[model samples]
Target: MKTHDLTSLLEAMFHQSKEMILFVDRHGEIVYMNAEAEKTLDLSDYDRNQFINICGHCMGMAASGDPDCTTCFLMSKEKLTFQVYMRTRYGKRVTYIANFQQIDPENNISVFTLNPLSELMKQQEFEHQKLLTQRIIQAQENERKRISRDLHDGVTQELLNVLLEMRLFKYTKDREELDEKIEDSEEMLSHLLDYIRNISVELRPASLDDLGVEAALKTHFKWLQKQYGILVDFNTNLNKKRYRPEIETVIYRIIQEAAFNAVKYSGSDEIMVNLKEAGSYNGIEIHFEIEDEGAGFLMGAEPKGSGLGLFGMHERISSVDGELNIDSEPGRGTKVEGYIPVGERIV
Candidate 1:
């Protein structure tokens, strides 16, 4: 193509672009605008060579006269670009990232360009929500730990001491009434101690840190069988010892969540938990699947509760650079699988 033809095509494309563009002279007068800008700001009344101040129409106020210019991020000449939400002539809110550049090397004739900031804002909002959810989970865990410690150290111990003192009194006094009361007190304390121990373990299983993953999981499965009567088929090919602490914690917690979900929602008599080494490799793969012949729902249907349980599980898996996959259908049990290439330093 000839140079003239290429020039004409470039100009036509620029003119027809959907992005709003405006060029202002050294004195801050509007000098040029693309087709979209005219429609965007209702610029039909604007005239050429007119002292067209776009302050009120484009950005809501004149550059030099607006009182907010002092704190407005756009006025920071040191920064070439910034983003803000501004009201347009159509009286609607729109986010825009503004870029300013000086056209003249020795003068202050700067050109300003704007691009919509909606996509960036959406991404930022998602990240903020993600962080907020994590903080909520941490706060909940802290509270649970507090309650567990109180029961284990204070309530349980105090009850035991009371029982001991009561037994000593039995030897000193020969009253039928007092003896019966002591027996009742002992029974109640026994039940309470058992309850407190369960609560403490649920809060944060000490076995998880003290014992390795294998031992902790064995205990967890026993608890599941005793409590829910759910037969969980567990298999381990872990020919290795211990894993990184954070990774272990993540795996344990996800298993807890997944298994709890299975018992609570899957309505299955039998489930499966498997942990094995990826053969001849340094990585490990963990799997927890719950299969049931129960009434299920659509996969896309909104989950019960705040729906953050699964989301939290996903985040935990991501922390270890792992992948989490959920498969569920109506009348079929849900299965959640997670794979983490073990030994990969997430940091």
Candidate 2:
């Protein structure tokens, strides 16, 4: 092919390419940009002759928030490729993989190319959701296995023992022996009833269905005090107000998990739980908060447990269009708050 034809073909390809391409001068001004570059970077409004520093669009290049022009690829003598975030004209931050090449060394001209990272980010988000689903399934299965073991090893075995004792009653011919066997059987039956009740409470307290969330929480806190010696200061202004079953369940579970985490890891003697109504006029929102003045873990650090508890809480809350916020710091305390919009209430 002739040299002129080759140059024309390359120019057409450059303008038609999806990636944003810019020709920058030595003074960091954008000398020229292709069609795709103008649209992607939202620079169509700016005149090409008017100098615009490229660093104004950068989201910093070092530890600080200020853009570091010294480390910019355009200033480097060698070619460079790296990831960077840029603020678009609409004020949205976008990630891009950029390549900078010194096209003309004598004239100090460089060509910069940028490929957006939106698709890569979407793929990552999808993979994260898949992992979350797997974790939820595993948690459910583990809980079922635990319940099964408890029933078989504890409740079922106890019942079998009671049955064996009753079989001995047939061999007892004396009235006194018969009376003694009957009393033993009665005591065993009573114990078995208590065990079953405990398991029922563990699964889902009957009070939660019969009364309301407040009553159920009181019962749970009382039980916690007796079992783990952790006192819970419970407060709620809802005054037995009822909500959709799904909302109630999500709030209950989130509080349950948060309180359990505090008791298990916080090492604090007391925790606080508060539930109230938030927002005004257009909508009503239910806000529940659990706070512990105990030893809290560092934010973003690996949790001591399976890390599924918080994840499950988030999943459950979000399912009901609720928001969950957790605040904690080492040697300080932890607070978990959730808000659910329950719509306008009837007067």
Candidate 3:
């Protein structure tokens, strides 16, 4: 393209682009700003008599991951690109990615451009939530299949056996034989009831809602020992304390998942679990920890199983507006600990 045509195209883009563009002289004066910059920046506070300075809009320059502008970017013309917090039109400080470079050495002028960080963050959050939803759906499907298989293989088959025994009992020739058949059928029915109850408890233990998280966890730890060879060194100071149903559920499920993950992948025969209420200056916080010394995996490595466990652990904790931290390393132990800001329950 001819130089004249190219200049027009560039000028058109400079005005029409969504990003904010500004031209600054070495004196820190704002020579020009795009329409977006005028719309987004809080330039009203600055004096119009004296030229508006870029410092008026910039709260700080974020460099090397630090938000503090220890060294001013305006002083250096290093073809820099970094995060900056700029004052917005509404008197709020918003983060933006800034690209600045000296374009006119003779005039000591530079071009400064800004792209809002909020837009990029919003897009990232949307993608994260989309992935989380997909994983949750898949987890639910797997759980349903597990329950269905348990009913079919365990409860249903056993019930069928009892039904056949009853049908044969009526054809028994001797009184003693009939009595024995009836007893056998009763025993089978009793075992079938236990199997159904186990499945029900796994779905959502009634103890979790009725007795609270402490009781539910105690019961669960015992079951964990029986179901898996791994023993849980359980300790708690909850003392039958009650919490919001949602809080109780979140704590129980997180610890449960952490322990199960330990059992499946940690290669440890024993795990330690602690639930305590500690006094904090603000209020009281409920703290819990699950630790196991086993074949821990790298934090960002591909999970041996579905990565949904860790994702669900985070998702569950976040639902209660709590904090969580997981520490693990290869050949070292894993510790999953966090606190829920319940403080002391208000009387």
Candidate 4:
């Protein structure tokens, strides 16, 4: 085939593509764009002189004022291909897998081909669901571990001592001596049984069903104080005492996760938790905040967690139709904040 024929075929394919495509000059000015690019970007009366900066719009890319944008994936000329989100002229935000290549040798002009991020968006949502499921399973496993430990170390050991006493009573030759040992053994066993029952209830309290979020949090925080000895400055101002069961469960779980993370990760000595109506609205909102003078990290970078603690926290918060915000800086401090809307419930 002739070179002209090949070029025509390539142009035809480019025009027919569903993804947006554009070519930029040495100064990042738009020089050429395909049909799809015009349609997807909703660009008309193309301004060839306008510079293309991925951070200039609704894209997740850092804005001009952003400290990290200087070293961002969008501005890095070294990368030949990468993925990023961009805002279109139509004002709709989208993620795009973009390719940049230096095609012009003399002027250093480049070509950029972009594909829509629909697939990635779907994948991210699916992963979010999977993350939530994993979190629930992990929480269940952790509860089982605590329960098992309590049974083994507390009740089970006490019962074993009682059993030994019972055996001694059975072997005793004197009736009076046998009676005293038997009574003591019976009392010990009874106390052990009660201890095991209490442990079981703590793992999954029946009161959670009979009571509500406030009660459940009160009990959990009491345990938190006992276990960690950290003072939790907790306050709840509510118009109602109870909420939908699902909402209550979500708030309870988020608080539990936040409190646990604070104790485990935050080196600070105090934490504040608040629950009340958020804003000028009828909806009840619960806020769980863990503020500590501990080590913090940059957002969007990988979080330091033993397993899925951070992931699980995010998942649980999402499940409740809530938002989780983490603010931290190295040696400065860390804060985990969760907001749950009661009227707009999520499970």
Best by TM-score: 2
Local lDDT at 213 for model 2 = 77
Candidate order by TM-score, decreasing, is 2, 3, 4, 1
Mind giving the per-residue lDDT tens digits that candidate 3 earns over 1-347?
54578788888988888999999999779998888878877557666743288877788877665567677778888556689998887778888988889999899999999988889889999999898788889889998999899989998899899999999986998999899999999999999989888999888899988888989998898889899877999999989888888889999999999999999999999999999999888878899999999999899898888788888889888988889999999999899999998855723
Candidate 2 TM-score, true structure as reference:
0.77
| Candidate 4: C-alpha lDDT | 0.69
lDDT of each: 0.68, 0.83, 0.87, 0.69
- TM-score for all predictions? 0.56, 0.77, 0.75, 0.61
* Model 2: number of backbone collisions: 0
Query: Is candidate 1 or 4 superior in TM-score?
Result: 4
Task: Tell me the number of clashing residue pairs for each predicted model.
Answer: 1, 0, 1, 0
Sort by lDDT, best first: what order? 3, 2, 4, 1
Worst 10 residues of 1 by lDDT: 59-68
The digit string of per-residue lDDT tens for model 1 on 51-101 reads 265454444322443424444432434345565444565667666777666
Which stretches of model 4 miss by more than 4 angstroms?
1-79, 82-95, 100-113, 117-168, 237-240, 277-279, 283-301, 310-314, 317-325, 329-347
CA RMSD per model (angstroms): 15.5, 4.8, 4.8, 7.0
Q: Which runs of model 2 end up more than 4 angstroms from their true locations? A: 1-68, 78-81, 85-93, 101-112, 277-279, 283-285, 344-347
List the candidate 1 regions with Cα displacement exceeding 4 Å. 1-120, 123-172, 175-192, 280-293, 344-347
